[model samples]
Target: MSKDFLEHKAFVELFDLHYGNLVGFVYGYVRDEEVAKDIVHDTFLTFWNNRKRLDLSYSAKSYLFTLAQNYALNYLRHLRVVEVNEREVSQLLEAASDELAEYDERYARVEEKLAQLPDKQREVFLKCVVEEKKYQEVADELDVSINTIKKHMSRALKFLRDELQGESILLFILSNR
Candidate 1:
């Protein structure tokens, strides 16, 4: 229609023609396709906004390349912060997983020690230590004499204490239980 409208349309066409190439160029620096696309999009938006002030004598391609470069640098700087944050998060997650694995190993060792006990002793120990039963209650439930329950409990504690004594940490864990 009008000269101004035609000029604007031509500018828009030029942007579309170079958009892919600009994105690819920025991607070379940024090493990320999405960031490259974003930088290129911002560059075009900035160019469009400054269209009226553009110097027609200067090459449009050169102007676009400069804009793309500046945008890519800014994107890279922003990515540095994101990268640091991601590394910190990964480290924290690894530490948490390591702690959980240690706890699981300790629990497994305690289970293994329990398995080593005589069947009657193991049952009595579980009822007293794990089930939190009193000696008289455990004796009534198991239909054993109170003295027999006490003897089983004494043997279970002695076996666990001796097996875990070398590892003070395990002793603390067992004592707390």
Candidate 2:
């Protein structure tokens, strides 16, 4: 969008026209009225901030929905990860000292894989996976978009998976003995 298109009048018109629908779309995923509103608000804020670089030819409506959908999905993914980690932590706490050492070794091996990634990917992977920070928080800290963070994360995961594929079978064989 051009600077003129992002002026208050145009921006307000855009918001007034679609804000409620966007919120409703988000509500379908989150199932909370307030959270849906907040997500829509954040989406508009991002749109306003990135107005200059936004492609004017495309349907802003589609872009808005896509943005909200990604946010909703990220929220769901984070919740799932949190619940799984809680369960895993409970089990690990009940595990014996030998299991703790084994966990540490496995973690070290994962860390080595992370180190092989590019610097930005490694940092993002660690901050997001190890430090348990949200993608938005990491994006704000790194001065990038959530989309960029997601891209880096996707690439990182793919690289790690391919790199670990053979190791996984080898480790299974060794550990079973």
- The best candidate by TM-score is 1
RMSD to the true structure for each prediction, in A, is 4.7, 25.9
The residue-by-residue lDDT of candidate 1 on 37-62, one tens digit each, is: 98898998898899889896998999
On the 0 to 100 scale, the lDDT of residue 33 in model 2 is 91
Candidate 2 accuracy as TM-score: 0.49
The per-model lDDT (C-alpha) reads 0.87, 0.83
- Kindly report which residue stretches of model 2 are placed more than 4 angstroms away from their true locations once superposed: 1-6, 94-177
Candidate 2 residue pairs that clash: none
Cα deviation at 166, candidate 1, in Å, is 6.6
Candidate 1 at 77: error in angstroms?
Answer: 2.9
lDDT accuracy of residue 39 in candidate 2:
88
